[model samples]
Target: MGWFGRKRDPQDANEMLRQYNEAEAARLAGLSSGSNLAPTTVSASFSSAEFAVEDVFTITGRGQVVTGTVASGVIRVGDRIVVLRDGADVGSSEITGIEMFRKKATEAAAGTLAGLLLRGRVDVARGDVIRTSASA
Candidate 1:
């Protein structure tokens, strides 16, 4: 009959959850409008500026696998050739080696040249997206 004596019904729990989610969404939306989120956008990444498909771009600085859900990883300088089947998930593609520089010339399209590990295939077109695996 008192405060401790009342059991929370499912409807009350659902309402509480809904309110929490709405509040959280509002907070995140506000935060994203600030500067910190700006630097992480794709347009802010080196990939957008430094890479060009069919034109083999290079980065002098080092890179880490900061974020990924890769099946395998490799870095080939030239035609060292670590082939991946089209549409293969990040976890299934095998990266046979690492190539810091292409001793010979290699080519890639701006959108097709993926990350350092070749995390995804050179298959993402101008506007396609491959998300990091949820479990990764």
Candidate 2:
């Protein structure tokens, strides 16, 4: 847990990457062996959630509520996430709730402006990037 609430292991990231690579290779394998197919390769992975924190505040009974834009990937309520500042990992927290336009949501996707209620003690500021512990 390192001064923060939780710490992520590099192995987890490696496992996700491995799975993505295997899936991509399998998909491409079929196309290349076909009689009339352009042996094309498409790669994708649930790398992480990139959010540019725009505001940070604490709600009386809800802990810290962070409003930001999901720059990439998707974030769901109950996902474990980390706060990053200046390209360094700071702390980890779980998403307690998600809200958009005053309506509760189960998930928020890239390019959406959403507010995430985080449980745990966090010291986040504007411009910080919130990334997920696992692929989202």
Candidate 3:
């Protein structure tokens, strides 16, 4: 049976699953082969990190928190960060904490969605770019 009481074809389901598996296998192979596909994580050799801010807010006792995906490189707790808006530097602060899905982490890499707790107040907002201070 299908949704709304319509009939479902068993062959169609099997074909769809087969196609999905094939695509997944290709994706995994690309990652393992280190093809031109964008990396899922930043390597240790990466020097600079960029995070695209999607949300920003202040935590009562912990200071400001910025949530976003790491666009490139890696970010770690205790690292100094600079905020950029429209390709211009806005302000700078220190990273006090990093978290993913409520789990504490010491660092996050490219393609990772994380929240960074800042050491002090900085003028940050949505659509800003956050990067390692050294890269500023």
Clashes of each: 9, 0, 0
Tens-place lDDT per residue, model 3, 10-124, is: 7786688679868856775676586776333322235678887889998898799999888788899988888888777899999999998779999998767789999889999
TM-score list, all predictions: 0.25, 0.65, 0.66
Q: List the residue pairs that clash in candidate 2.
A: none
Segments of candidate 2 deviating more than 4 angstroms: 1-45
If the candidates were sorted by their lDDT against the true structure, best first, what order would they fall in? 3, 2, 1
**Candidate No. with top lDDT:** 3
Query: Considering every candidate listed, which one attains the maximal TM-score?
Result: 3
Give the clashing residue pairs of candidate 3, or none.
none
Comparing 1 with 3 on lDDT, the higher-scoring candidate is 3
Mind giving the per-residue lDDT tens digits that candidate 1 earns over 1-136? Answer: 6779978556786688679868855764675577474213222222212221122223344322111111222223332222222333323222222332232223333322234334334442322223322222
Q: Model 3: C-alpha RMSD to truth?
A: 8.1
Give me candidate 3's TM-score against the actual structure. 0.66
> Could you report the Cα RMSD, in angstroms, for every candidate shown?
16.5, 19.2, 8.1
